[model samples]
Target: MSSTKNENCYIIKLGREASLSERANELEAAAASGNCRKLLQLIRATGSKKSDVSETICEDDGMPVTNSHRCLERWTELFEGQFN
Candidate 1:
């Protein structure tokens, strides 16, 4: 596998681990806490090619978020929607 592919796999693994651990809320919070953007940027910078890393923000419902910003939005919706 190529380096980029390896990075992608690592990210996916991280997401899966987070979801399996039932820490979606904490993950979502961390993602929306501004640091995620920086971390995402660092991850992107390490890649030789541009590829979407949104899959790294796996939703608890099995829905895949396709962008960092949208990931945050979806998490907000999922959490807040619970009350409505």
Candidate 2:
């Protein structure tokens, strides 16, 4: 589980473990182009309303899970109660 944290948001990686600093660097580099739409797209596509990106970082509860549309959808539905 990896996570990127900023003042306003946290983006967590579902499939692997990466340091917060590394995730932050990746986001910074991606944002340097002045277009973070791709970043937003990924978040909008995968984020869970209840569990949040922070969930991926705390694994003592369980190991980090993989990233797939199906997994995201299931998680979203379980957490937010909205699935379509």
Candidate 3:
């Protein structure tokens, strides 16, 4: 039996995908190269100025807040206070 053009195209695509996905070890080794801190610094350095405000969130009492919920509450409070 003969396959159609779409079937042949799909088979070729699957072969290419399978070959590309076979580099698990290389991907893992690249990820474990220990450049995480540098990557984070680069991301932060390129980030917008608006994001800087949330980078060091603190409560009204002058205590640093790490909790996501508390940070959101602090942001909400600040945003709401501007209207009053």
For model 1, residues 14-42, the per-residue Cα lDDT tens digits are 99887656554545555678688765665
Candidates 1 and 2 compared: the better one by lDDT is 1
The list of candidate 2 runs beyond 4 A from truth reads 1-18, 41-84
Clashing pairs in 1: none
lDDT of 1: 0.71
lDDT of 2 at 59: 30
True lDDT of residue 75, candidate 2: 72
**Model 2, residue 65: C-alpha shift (Å):** 32
Best by TM-score: 3
What lDDT score goes with residue 26 in model 1? 48
* Residue pairs in clash, model 3: none
Q: Each model's C-alpha lDDT?
A: 0.71, 0.54, 0.71
Runs of candidate 3 with Cα error greater than 4 angstroms are: 1-54
- Candidate 1 — which residues are off by over 4 angstroms? 1-63
lDDT of 3 by residue, 42-61 (tens): 45554565634447678878
Of candidates 3 and 2, the better by lDDT: 3
